[model samples]
Target: MHSVDKWIEIAKECKYLPENDLKRLCDMVCELLLEESNVQPVSTPVTVCGDIHGQFYDLMELFRTGGQMPDTNYIFMGDFVDRGYYSLETFTLLLTLKAKWPDKIVLLRGNHESRQITQIYGFYDECQTKYGNANAWRYCCKVFDLLTVAAIIDECILCVHGGLSPDLKTIDQIRTIERAQEIPHKGAFCDILYSNPEEVDTWAEFPGEDGFWGAPKVVFQFVHINGLKLICRAHQLVHEGFKYMFDEKLVTIWSAPNYCYRCGNIATVIDFKDADNREAKLFKAVPDNERVIPSRTTTPYFL
Candidate 1:
């Protein structure tokens, strides 16, 4: 393993790491993530963050407001790449921190982490552009496959990138899911990663794809079966940066402030303390300063 200082240096500058270093970092992190179950168990007094979406500056702003790794245990509900300008930098920093403090950081898989999604969104192109090749992108996808699907905080709050799955009624069912593969088109895995609670009933179905019913019923069964009190997720955008639905039985926390640099929405993170208290901290997108802006031309990636 490379020195922690080397990774920290790369993170500080948001520099494009060499291909070898990137591969090594991904390999190390993959080993750690592979050992974790689909329903990763975590303790309290940890801050739960939502979708990052490559908003590296906002992520830095998050650390500024919430504190850095090891100092504060963090559960990142994922979407660490795509849409924003610094997918490479944003994800690499989180991976480095996870590698450094494996027990301090919990990185879950978001819908955008998959190969098909990244290629359509921004991460794949960002990796290719940053390294002048696809090796870095490939390495990162391997790590993505290893990322956990969800986390149970204090055995009460279930943190997932998306909401409940019809096929999965219990935490043990979720554990039976075979991860480490590309996100499927349909089924419990894809549903948890892509389905939304609000749109479930009204969702249009394509061939071979199942229809999602509604948030309330699904969430109730999931929580009841797992013996959990709440479910936290982050696939939808909320104007206030967070939204409580189904009588606060489910919460959606979105950390990508001003999504796509145009949504004009706020971002938030929820801190869960040991005393069984949950506090939601709201923050805004970072100012359009030169330091935080991407140096390379980012037009092609979006196209």
Candidate 2:
């Protein structure tokens, strides 16, 4: 709770998705990144986050479960809006931290950052109700532009919202993406933002559909990829709120507990404290009644 009050005060005035313009998000984010990109990267302690679908209170649970900020820089792997309730509350909290301590928080971009996705989920509507559609659209673009696609900490670990696509041969290529589109089209860029878990239970490779062609191959190719010990992401929903996919090389962190429509599963995260002590801990933050094994209706809400 470092300056939680001041943070909230700033959040009160923070923008929402409805107020944003989808076309200009990345430019704004790049500009902001340039301002603090000079901040020395540190491994003092880092929390690798998954996806948070508007569960702001659950984010508080994460802050309580993993530990607080300033002491440990937070890396949010996107989806700060849509689904659940309180998109504004959730984005405001994270935005406030970014505004207050730019050096301590690294927020990555997720597929849901786009206006198209938010419209289907809850954020777009929430914004209209709270800030009106016009404001929501404007804030949406600004927030999207502010998101980071990937973050390299001391060049040891690489993190993003989605896993590697088959065509992506290296990490450097990920950095060069202009990342300025309002939304991704079907291509290399779309593949990056829209990738899913590489599991038969979750995804079937579309041999020719091509989008999922190179995904499942990421783990086997890990040794060839340089400067990456692990790839962390959060896109697909986990029954437990977080699923460690791709034979552990890729980890999915869902910071949103009891995800969309209250499925009643708990979310989790990974913390790297030192070289040999990188740990994955799962905690149930959802209430017991809802935390039961989700029924067959437990489909991923990403659609």
Candidate 3:
């Protein structure tokens, strides 16, 4: 069986929807799959990245820090365009890279990818704010919809833009993201958007109220649930550019240096491959103590 077939089989087993529904859903997802096929065709020895929030210069630094693209298959966990000054340039550069090395880049959808979020957090708003928003909206939205929900490499590591959610009953649950849903609501879509890693979720009451869901058990559950070693995700600024959670069941990486209105903390990513037998480690693009920007802003991301 081919890789895609194996993915579908696993997704079918862990399906929340019935088989008939699964087929229908997959039929819709089929087009997305085809488009993605030409988008990032390679997937080994991949370097997984975290959030890149429109800091165009920093992103260039990141590529330097992380090393050249496609040489090591690239997986960007999400948050490619937002919160900084150069979303247009950043997104265009990434898209160009994707087009050139269609076989090497893995792009995941983040909270910012949704239309609503983009209207607020994407380059659309930034363009409007910075460039008067004339014709940017049309092209930016087109690129936004093309982003994928998640990417799994070698069935050993899973990657997503945000934290895990209670709605995810199994690993295959994420591996099989429908990727065909409309945005701007707090449904399964919101869960993906708001998902965050927190210890409280592990020992929380049923129907947890944090709204988004995640826990160490879920990591193990999903790992055992899917037979993968580690899940790598990007979202949540790690002062150190990356963080390890759930006894290392999940690793949170941030490729955006000086996240969230330029706090000045750098970023990091991990490179893994079959040659090294799927081993993973954290690589930093910048450092934490370096956040000495000499000014402070009251703007908050969590709120």
lDDT per model, in order?
0.83, 0.63, 0.60
lDDT of model 2 at position 19: 32
Query: Model 3, 184-300: lDDT tens per residue?
Result: 445444565557777764733325422465777777787787777777787787878778888777888887665665566657767776523543343433443532221435232
Which prediction has the highest TM-score against the true structure?
A: 1
Provide C-alpha RMSD values for all models, in order. 2.5, 6.1, 11.4
Q: 1-303, model 2: which lDDT tens digit per residue?
A: 554445455444433332332223323444666554311244637887888777655677788788877677778887887765667667766765665567788887787788777777767666666765546445555667546677766565667676666556776676666675665656555666667655453334555433553344555475246656666777777877556555656667776766764566777888878544677667666454532332434233444
lDDT ranking from best candidate downward = 1, 2, 3
* Residue 107 in model 2: lDDT: 80
- Ten contiguous residues minimizing lDDT sum, candidate 1: 202-211
Q: For model 2, what is the error of residue 67's alpha carbon versus the real structure, in angstroms, after optimal superposition?
A: 1.3
Name the runs in model 2 displaced over 4 angstroms: 1-31, 34-44, 199-210, 213-216, 286-303
TM-score of each: 0.93, 0.78, 0.74
By lDDT, the best candidate is 1
Give the Å error, residue 203, model 1. Answer: 9.2
Please report the TM-score between candidate 2 and the true structure: 0.78
